[model samples]
Target: MPAGEVRLVFCNAPDRDCAERIARALVEQGLAACANLLPDCLSIYAWQGQVEHAHETPMLIKTTAVRLPEVIGLIQALHPYEVPEIIALPVTEGLPAYLQWVRGQTLPLDKSA
Candidate 1:
């Protein structure tokens, strides 16, 4: 894979509905090729100096690095949390064909220029 061509974006939502909505939006907008939502995760963290625990859905978004900014922006807009976690990790190694498919899926269908 080309350097920075692929990335795995991580985000957390308060509930399953929110996770599904966010994931669908991202994939529909071509910001992500796919999103795998993991539900019923217990997240324990500190916020505003208080320890908090909540059930969260963790979404793994697959997309290109080129589309990361737009992905983050969309997640921020749609997420309900005051500080939604959005992080991206570069995909250094993967099956070549799958990586290519991700690149292709993220491109706009209308290629006219």
Candidate 2:
């Protein structure tokens, strides 16, 4: 895979359990190479013309660009929020081996070998 093919996906879950569930499913299903559940996050945003605040668990997901669509779809299906925070940023640079590992890890089961 090329450098720009890797993506860093950011998603926030309602809590630690939800974060863990999403992360595990992503990795186990080969949709993501890794998902790091970060410390509690305080999110303040406007919704339905009203301001809201909540504690969330931020997740940093690693996967190839090719798998981004599946990653997003799965998150949407499992996420509790009506509109979950799912964003992907291109990884322009990183350790070569690590990037390769991510690409390999996210490949479909048949293609991984």
Candidate 3:
């Protein structure tokens, strides 16, 4: 069953410090309820028409649809690379209590921002 109770955003950073900074920014900005940082990840991809490889940390950010755009803009402004990967997945199924908690944590996004 499609819950549509929450949203999951996948974000990656070059290292722990970068991930931490991003996480803090999201939380402080009332964007994410929680974020998990996984480090020591090896990634290989094509960038600038060349193959690139690097160690990175991935973050699983839990938030709501209302705050998504702000999250994207913040990441783009803060990320060091020219292009960053930021993908969002709808939470099809989740415990209702947890989903509610996520909603409670993120404040309503201002339309003017």
Best candidate, TM-score-wise?
2
In order, what is each prediction's RMSD in angstroms? 2.2, 2.4, 3.3
> In candidate 3, which residue ranges exceed 4 Å CA deviation?
1-5, 109-113
Question: After best superposition, candidate 2 residue 31: deviation in angstroms?
Answer: 0.7
Worst 10 residues of 2 by lDDT: 104-113
Cα lDDT tens digits, model 2, 1-113, are: 45339999999999999999999999999889999999998999999999999999999999988889899999999999999999999998999999989988987666555
Pull out the clashing pairs in model 2.
none
Per-residue lDDT for 1-113 in model 3, tens only? 22234789998898889989999999988888999998569999998899999999999999888778888999888888678889999887878899989988886755899
Per-residue lDDT tens digits for candidate 1, residues 40-89, read 79999999999999999999999987788889999999999999999999
Q: Whose lDDT is higher: candidate 1's or candidate 3's?
A: 1
Using TM-score as the yardstick, the better of models 1 and 2 is: 2
Ten residues in sequence with the least summed lDDT for candidate 1: 104-113
Leading candidate by lDDT: 2
Q: How many clashes in each candidate?
A: 0, 0, 1
The runs of at least 3 residues in candidate 1 whose Cα sits more than 4 Å from the true structure, single-residue gaps closed, are 1-4, 108-112
lDDT (0-100) at residue 75 of candidate 3?
A: 87
